[model samples]
Target: MTGAFDGLKVVVHVFGKVHDAGDGQGMLCRLDLEGLELVATQHRVEAGASPRTVRFPLRTTEISYGGTDDGKLVLKTPEHILYAERDELEPELKRLGLVSLDHVLSRERQLLGGRRRKGLAVWVAVLAGCIALAFGALWLADWAVARAVDLTPAPWEVQLGQAVLDGQTWDEVTDPEVIEPVGKITERLMAEAGEHPYDFRFKVVRDPQVNAFALPGGGVVIYTGLLENADTPEELAGVLGHEVQHVLWRHSLRGLYDRLKWHVLVAMVLGDISGAQELLLAQAAGLMQLSYGRGMEREADRRGVELLVRAKIDPQGLHDFFGKLSEQEGTPESLTLLSTHPSSRERQEYLKELIEENSGARYQPLDVDWEGLQEKLKGGAGIER
Candidate 1:
């Protein structure tokens, strides 16, 4: 994205009569790279009209091209009124850091009558190419981050997970009755699961919101609201298995990766791994609000059902749990981010088909008094550790 534009010229005008200042409709302006300014000259119009030269320093001068800076009209500025007609001048000005990309966007918004949502595609364009990578290496950095993210080590990932937890609120459940059952079930599922590098930790959060989330480093949080909604041991196991599968598949890590802005990702990739961890820690509270992508969510569902089957728990639990959640009117505003996962109805249907297709596999109920335990949990009674 780097180039030399020493003599780039644009023929432009100012409000000499109609808008800004003095004389001509258009004049040739050269972006002087050396002086860090724009200099344009006007020759005598008639016999004795005065010749004029306009200079705007890069620092003090602000540029308004009406739209994104790459190809735009330099219509508004403070010291002089000038317009540049050439397409090549503005990009060079942007490339040289003389013109502010932020200012360019602000002007575009102003011209659109402050319509925020209308020209979003244009916003994405400005953000994607010229703004972030002013020096032109943004794509290389994207490629680098994409490639380097996988090579990040497991311990570092655990630290990233810890960072995730450090930012969010957690109401750790202490009742042995609640705590022990969760552990036992998780152990059963893990026994059934294949090899994994994560040392999983499951915690019951006393939140009344009906949601569960997975974080890097095998961190799983289940809200009490979800437990209260489940009528059977299979229902509990259904959602639990889904979250655990997210950990196994490294979905937590990928979620963090996806939320990162391009420049931020580039910085973290170029900097140390801990810098990335610090970035993750800073954003940990929002991790729950980060929804796993549709494909990732669907994969978790598929793997979740398989884990249930292998563990002798009924695979239908996954289907039943999702089916029930999707039946709700609208997801709560608090749980909006996590609850409204992509294609809920479709996901539930897919889970049902998975169960029906695998019906030949032997299935057995969980050997636990799940209902009695739920009642005890509701009553705020618990077995001690």
Candidate 2:
């Protein structure tokens, strides 16, 4: 049977132990609802079982349960539910705040929803602002780094080359006999190269790898393997001349500047100098992995040929060296050079053509002490040569 209130929707705030007939358990609750109360006359199921349906009627805006001294359930009309005992009803109704229940629930829902929306909007705006600042910071950092540093690969590269050489001096493998000869060759080349803005230095490393490289600080390093392969002084001079051109052009600095520009941009965005430093170090390491571009390689080669011609040395020495290196194209040692500076065949052909055009007529060749250098390199006990 339908009880006192059946069809009305009610917002509830329950308190104390309310039996959930469906769930088969007693629940502590605080229910604030108008026109709804638990049905009293419904058949009581087992003590802990949930009722299929609540059968009581609600006649008032407020109610209280379990208020009787004898444990009998009572329904109060239109406003309140009171049990048969006055002593039981007085304490529970007062504690439940039945007088102001309806007003509190209505105000709570209104204020809570408005505050939630406002807080969500504030968080969204903050997130958007952070994103914009990140991009702006990166842009400013990039601009600043571009203005502050010059990364062109030039004479400074030679300094690094020298440093690498100097570092080798403390090593046990450095042969004292060749030091003087290497020094003499470097001095002569520097004098012939003429004065420029960058401070240049040359190094002869003890490595067997046939390679030479320039650093950003005017340092040029030539490996011993390359030196041993040169049958004539002119061939060695050609290699040195080409490396010197790389230093003069500041190619190392240019590569560094390009990579560092992006790093500085990131640093600016983050407002951290440490990030910039890390980026620079990483870029420096990458510099070793770089090879001169094709145009740059050709320019250096042409310049070197010009230097040898002006120095009264035969340019054929360069072509011969390139020819030897071209033969080892598939080998592991030669792969390093090819990987960085591709077009070995093309370069060799170009050098051969230049040698034909410039030195087809009979010309005197400077005598190079090749046998003595080779003997010295063999680790002989005496320095007779």
Evaluate all candidate structures by whole-model CA lDDT and list the values in order.
0.66, 0.58
Candidate 2: tens digits of C-alpha lDDT, residues 120-153: 8999999899999988877775575654344323
lDDT accuracy of residue 375 in candidate 2:
72
Model 1 scores a TM of 0.60
> How do all models score by TM-score?
0.60, 0.51
Question: Backbone clashes per model, in order?
Answer: 8, 46
Tens digit per residue, CA lDDT, model 1, 1-385: 1234345544433222112465455554333444444665554355778656666555455555544543455544554665554355555555555445446645764865545454677788888877667655656655545544675677877777776666666666777777777677778888988887888887787767877777877888777777777778788788888888888778777676656646455666576655665666677767667778788888988889889988988977767766666666376723442453544667767888888878889977677767766776789753222
For model 1, where is the 10-residue window of minimal lDDT?
A: 10-19
